[model samples]
Structures are given as C-alpha cells and as structure tokens.
Target: MRVKLIESRKVYDGEVSMRLERFSINGRTVDKEIVEHRPSVGIIAVEDDRIFLVSQYRRAADRALLEIPAGKIEEGETPVAAAKREMDEEIGYSGTLKPFLKWYLAPGYDTELMHLFVAKNLHRIPSRREMDDDEDIAVKKVRLDAAVKKCFSGEITDAKTIAAILAYRLKPI
Candidate 1:
C-alpha cells in the first residue's frame, strides 16, 4: 500500500503542532489531522532488581500516571542522547543504554516515533539536570517482578511503559 500526501496545512502550532492533511491512497482522497511531533525516547532504567519510573500529572490523561522516564529528542540530538538526558532529568540517574525497540506512539494521526531503551549499570548523577518548568515529576522505584505484575494488572497504564516492561521481561538484555 502506498499513501501520497496531497496537501498539508498547519492547523495548530505549539509545543506540538497539528497539520490538516489530505492524502491519496489507491485513488481515494482522504483527510487526516496529523500531529506533527518530534521523535522521543523512553528508558527502562534498572539497578539491581528495581526499575526507576516517574509519576506525573498528564494534562491529556487528567491524572497522575506512572511512566518510564521519557522525553522528546531535542533538535540536533540523537535518540541515545535524549534517553540519557531524560533519565538524568526525570530520575537523577544514568546508565549504559541499549536500544530495545522503536515504534510510533500513534500512527493513525501522530508522527511521534518512540525509541525504547534498556538502561543498566545505573549510577546516580551528582548534579542531575533540573526538570522542565512545566513538569512536576516524582520518582518511584519498584521491584522488577512487581512492576511486571502491575503491567499485567493494568496498574501501569502507560503504553510505552507497559511495552518496555513486558518486552524486557520476555527478553532481558
């Protein structure tokens, strides 16, 4: 299947922009509201048997969510660099990072590709970066086994976190 963009116009612009797009697929013209978002990184930071996570209030979710440390890749930044930076800012830790998986957050309308990473051999940063002004995050450390149970019991509702924990459990790096 081939999809060709017919036209795109900026509909909203902010931290994340939105574009009204027309596409041609197999001779049919369809319209979609595409969210123009930068690629992001999520880290499954592990030390011993615990996984570092963040709990923060998400405007879209309307509640505090427990999620793996994650953030958007800054302009001119590599995914690995973003992962490290996010870990430092959100969890005050750093480690050896290995690529685990990469996938679109929501392909139907969003252009945000998420780079998942497994971070091990963790060390606390003496001078970790400050969290973003708009962010109020609290760090949470959970046992790996219990975290996996949360993923199964729906306590961990964040998609990226669920995928990372389950994937790591299924195939540890």
Candidate 2:
C-alpha cells in the first residue's frame, strides 16, 4: 500500500491546531481532518502499594476525570523531563522514571502521541511546581489493585490512566 500526502492546510490554531489533510492512496484521494498536537507524557507514580492520580475538570469532557499525571512535552524538553515535570505539577512527587509505553491518543483524527512511564522510589517535592493557571487539579491516591478495578469499573475514565493501570497490573515495571 502506497500513501502520498497531497496537501495539508492549517484550519484552526489555539492550544491545539487542526489540519485538513488530503492524501492519495493507490490513486484514491481521501481527506482527513487531523488535530495537530504536541507529544505528551503520562506518569504512573507508584510508592509501596499506592498509585498517585489526579482529578481535574476536562473542558472537552465537560466533567471531572481521574487521570494520571500527564502533560505536553514543552519545546526543547525531552519526554522524561516532561514526565518528571508533570509529576511535580500534578502529583507533587519526584521519582526514578522508566519508559513504559508509547502510543497515539487518537490516531483516527489526532496526532497526539503519549509516552507512558512508571515512576518509582517516589519522594514528595517540598514545594511542588505550580500547575497551569487554568488548571485546578486534586491529587488522589489509590491502591495498585484498586486502581485496576477502577479502570474496569469506569471510575477511572482517562484512556492514558486506564492503559497505564492495566499494563502495570498485567506486568509491573
């Protein structure tokens, strides 16, 4: 299968941008609206039997959601640095980070790739980094086993958080 990019035009720009992409596959032209987004990192911070999570209102979802500490990798920042920084800002912890998984958040129409990490040997930051001005986040601690149950019970609704918990349960890093 051969795919060729015919054209891409930025249609919307803000916190994230939208691109209208026209592609040709095997002489068949197709158009897809892609959401241009920066790569991000999600951290599963574990200590003893507890896993740290954050609950915040997501504008898109129109409600509060329980999610792992996560954020975009800023310009010139590596994914590891983003993971550590997100932990500090969202969960107020620092730890040794290990790469876990990398996957696209919504490949069908989005370009956001999420790098997942397992953060162990945790220590609370004396003065946690301030979260983004528009964000109001509350940290939550859950037992490792219970977190998995929440994933299945629909209590934990974030895709990245569900993926991390299930993956960690299947095989702890």
| Best-performing candidate as measured by TM-score | 2
Instruction: Residues 1-173, candidate 2: write the lDDT tens digits.
Output: 99999999999999899999999999999999999899999998999999998999999999999998899999899999999899999888899999999999999999999999999999999998878986899999999999998988999888888988888889899
Decoy 1 TM-score against native: 0.95
Q: What does the lDDT come to for candidate 2?
A: 0.92
Alpha-carbon RMSD of each model: 1.2, 1.0
The TM-score values for the models, in the order shown, are: 0.95, 0.96
The 0-to-1 C-alpha lDDT of every candidate, in the order given, reads 0.93, 0.92
Q: Which sections of candidate 2 miss by over 4 Å?
A: none
* Inter-residue clash pairs, candidate 2: none
Error of 1 at 128 (Å): 2.1
lDDT, candidate 1, 1-173, per-residue tens: 87899999998999999999999998899999999999999999988889998999899999888999999999999999999999999999889999999999899999999999999999989997988887899999999899999988988899989888888888888
Error in Å for residue 112 of model 2: 0.8
- Please report, as a residue range, the 10-residue window in candidate 2 with the lowest summed lDDT: 126-135
